[model samples]
Target: MRALTGHPLRPVTEMSPQRVLLVNLACMGAPALLIIQGVLQHGKVDWFAAGLGCITLFALVALRMFDLVSQVHDKARQLDAVAHIDALTALPNRRAWDLELSRRIAAARRHGSPVVVAILDLDHFKKYNDEHGHQGGDNLLSSAAAAWRGQLRPEDLLARYGGEEFGAIFDQSKLADADRIIERLQAVNPLGQTFSAGAAQWNGSETAEELLARADVALYAAKAAGRNRVYVSSIR
Candidate 1:
């Protein structure tokens, strides 16, 4: 089970070896003492054997309970991953992106750090899907996500916001630096595909929604101008 789940059973049990030993001793100590007393007083092997059997039963039950708890923990982790991750591209989904954006905004407000948000939309994605099949489009999306993720810093987050759209958050980074990173991602797009992006720096007072809306506005502006360029939102 540990091999299949790729997680340790210890974390789910939440018990150290010392604690587990103490618990086992507590459960079996009385029976063991009774068996010893019976053996010493009456010299009966039957009494000792019965006590040993009971202790073995208790140990087996404890082991089963621990296994069940570990299974539950593993299943819960799997469910969480399915909820927050996009199945197609294997990237964080829109819900995860929203939560992360809010978290980054809160951290920036508290620490006076910089936050840059960008929205990128693949150019002519629907047309590409029409020309190639949906499966082809999916493969492209997955490939593009892998390529773009490789180009980003580990601290930066890039998520699949929705169909053919990705969201990025650059933490503790200047807007100019974030823009350059986005350009690098654009260059690495798979199959010679192009994407238009819009970026906005946090104003230190606006909500996450407002900041993203500004970037979305810039994205529309970029699409209107041309479909393969990056636009920076004007500071308000």
Candidate 2:
């Protein structure tokens, strides 16, 4: 209904108009020709011709049906992707981040691996927005998101947690590894701006929410100490 979210202006159907016409022609034209042939042959039914026509009709119908099903499946997948993505930056949004954190925590507990969570806030983001227009701020944010996303490992997750803030989940990583990755993200970002981050490796007994809260506390500490640094939570 919404043109499959990001894919706007796409044709209503995945199949082209010409292809649709071709399918319809094969479905109807072959049967009509066979019937005409039977009539011309003194109504003695051209069994061979009719059989071929029937097969062609069924095959065309099956092809069209499969294409429709595939289109539906693709559309559904696009919708799901849209739901989890930030419209501006095309990065995973807060909802996706939350789910990923829970998933990673569960997996880490099972495998006796570490799950590191971090919260990053752009330094003096308000000043940047005030100096540059909203559009400029948005461009900066998107660029930063892209750059940070590139720094993540296959086992890591980076998501926009709303307005100038991002969340990261490092599966099978400890606090030290998280710090290194965050430093890397800050270093590579094209915005030429710094961010303050707070991170904590998941403790065996804590929930994802508790883990995030600890990271948040550490993040605020980083802001209090200096603008461009990372603080690791000391609580377990």
Candidate 3:
């Protein structure tokens, strides 16, 4: 009755380990004080002796449970982080980009708005890697992706499209808008790090696959044009 009237102390079942340890220490220490007072006054030690063992057991159990829960939470967070990032470049990976692309494409198609697809392939990338070594190639790819991402709108979709290639999907964008973006991306990337890009605005005449193939042809044309430039499918 006295304990209930003072205030309701919350249960320790959900409390953190540090808090639980402090509370248990306080509880056990109080009993020791009471026992010392009782024994000194009347030669009795039952209160302290009885409560000490139970408090010790409870603290051990709480600490064990806290460690287990913390380990599990840490593992879950690591897995979630890995799911969205590319293993190679640590960029938001192809899987994450694909999901965003499908969503944007559906929205654009429904609203009768324009969307642009740009495919970029590094010019002479194999030769560059062969001459510079694998580590240099990895560094170049990482730098290129970062530069491209920096030039994109917050809503733009960018993904590494296999070896030495990348894909970008820009919704509600025109050819001129895509051209500006490509220029900015190229400008920030390293010198001699040139890419051929093919861009196409959605025309309702082609599936995504067909549209991408057309973009690839334009990319090849851009490469044939001496590289380091953007070409639209309409121009091709």
Candidate 4:
């Protein structure tokens, strides 16, 4: 029984919930038929046999309930991935960006580490999309995401903020260090495209929203001055 339990039933546990339920029904049916037959023949119930059957049925029901719970947990994980991931570029989406920014800011406050937030916008993306079809634009975005991600450190997080725009958090980096890294990103810009970026270092006393707003101000400044340049926010 120990050998059979270790080897034969191992595969059964991996079977689908429907198949296991059907197997359980079949096993229970045989015991039920026997119990009914004994009662009819002897004009008496088999208490010991009835007790064993009940135990078997209870165990099978518990297994089915556990399988259902596991399935629900898997589905929940899939939904979380969909909510936080960008379908196009395969990067973290804006919802994920906000969450990560807040988390990183909290960590920086606790550890007294520098953190930089940057926003990058492709120069003349609307015109690019107009010239090329949407498919081409999408390919460009995917390629650029891959390229930029390769240039950054593993700890740095780059996310898709919105259409043709990206957001990044540089962990333990000052504004100048982040600026240099963004320059590297620009150097490897895909498909002859260019981007403008704005970066702000955390000033020891600012909310995530305030830091992002400062970065956003610098981003617009880059766009206004001329496209294809990096601007560090003047806000200390």
Candidate 5:
């Protein structure tokens, strides 16, 4: 709705409880005026109108209460999103990756499905920062994340592990598929830059920590051998 000045009215979610109370108080004024009129006019009272006015006041109060509840739910939704998101890359942050890993590992163990965990590191990333500055580095990460995520399945999760590093978890995937996906991510251009990835297929016997640790070791080897390639760990 537009206000009298032709500006769009603020959404109820943006309104504070105090503002809602003020609006409800304004609505109550009309009914309250009628009730006061009834009481002051000598002995004969309009019982029906008085009851209706009371109902109106009660309804306004109820609506304000519902609005307050909606605001609470809105806050929770926003907090949940903020907690999981990486501000720079718009990818899931490390905390979100950890939570997802734990949940998916439990399910994989129950169903005997293989899961793949990989760590991705930007190749010569520090050199890029030295040449282009921090903002440039952040842009590179964001570009890389968007490009990689566009190719991912809905169920696949990619997260920012830390500076110049990323994490990915693929459900029901074998080592071969993980290798292919990692290669694809390497090919995605982060401003004509490249990355190195180390992928491991979970053996169903190791914890999530072990899986990530093994992937990290493989990543180290990838950097050791040469950068801009994927190294697969057959940990199973």
Candidate 6:
């Protein structure tokens, strides 16, 4: 329609309020010429009517165009938010936690500070599901995630690692710090439950996966030792 009317069409991204003004001015150019010609060459169109019609059309088009742009911006923000959030627990997901861990580890290595990784598994979670049903277990896990989230610092990263398992990355801390965190988590009961956790400190050379694996081993040891305590890796 714009091309047929002798107005140049630009791509949507190239559009701006100034460009919209230029396009409207360009459209008005034709009607202004036509109105002048009608006065000089005898009436073919009315000058006042043509100018008013052109201004009104331009106003409506510009309004619609800006409305569409605002909608696109809002949708982009919504998608970015969904990417970082875990739908089930409403906590940070694994990907978000990995990014946090990377930043913390970089700062710790530079400043000779400690960062701790703790991997948590619900004690006898499979047996709990078998005895209490899957829905009951899910309610417990959700309650547990909420409990741990409350214990975290603003810089801490807590995520659902998998079925009956969760993890955290704590900045400026050691493996021993997990004892207090574990105690806080165990004190409350939606189902009279407890967690087994393994913790290990970042050693400068270890990747996040390696750190998590060491924590997992400690978690196994804690589970073996009794199912309600925190264990620092004996190897590290």
Q: Which parts of model 3 have CA positions greater than 4 angstroms off?
A: 1-81
lDDT of 6 by residue, 100-173 (tens): 77888788978988888888889888999999898888888889888887877777778877788888887887
Estimate, for each residue in 1-236, the C-alpha lDDT of model 1 and write its tens digit: 12334664344556789978987786776677667877787855566556677777788778878887777977787777678888888788999899999999999999999999999999999999999999989988999999999999989999999999999999988879988999899889999889999999999999998999999999999999988999998778
lDDT of each: 0.87, 0.84, 0.77, 0.88, 0.84, 0.77
Off by over 4 Å in 2: 1-44, 189-192
Cα-based RMSD of the predictions, in order?
6.9, 4.7, 11.2, 7.1, 5.6, 9.9
TM-score of 4: 0.84
Can you give the TM-score per candidate against the true fold?
A: 0.80, 0.77, 0.65, 0.84, 0.82, 0.74
Model 4: weakest 10-residue lDDT segment is 1-10
lDDT of 5 at 188: 71
- Estimate the TM-score for candidate 6: 0.74
Of the two candidates 1 and 5, the one with more favorable TM-score, higher being better, is 5
lDDT of 4 by residue, 68-125 (tens): 6776665566667778888899899999999999999999999999999999999999
Model 2 Cα lDDT, one tens digit per residue, 1-236? 14345454324565679987987787787668767877788767767777887887798788867977776777777878788988998878999898888887888888888788899999998899999989889988989988888888988878899899999888878888888899898898776788999999888879998998999999999999977999999757
Alpha-carbon error at 232 in model 4, in Å? 0.2
Per-residue lDDT over 74-139 for candidate 3, one digit per residue giving the tens place of the 0 to 100 score: 555655556766767666666766776666667876898888899988888898899999988988
Find the candidate with the highest lDDT and give its number: 4
Work out how many backbone clashes candidate 3 has: 0
For residue 77, model 5's alpha carbon misses the true position, in angstroms, by 0.7
Residue 195 CA displacement from its true place in model 5, Å:
1.4
Runs in model 6 with CA error above 4 Å? 1-59, 234-236
Q: Which stretches of candidate 1 lie over 4 Å from their true place?
A: 1-47
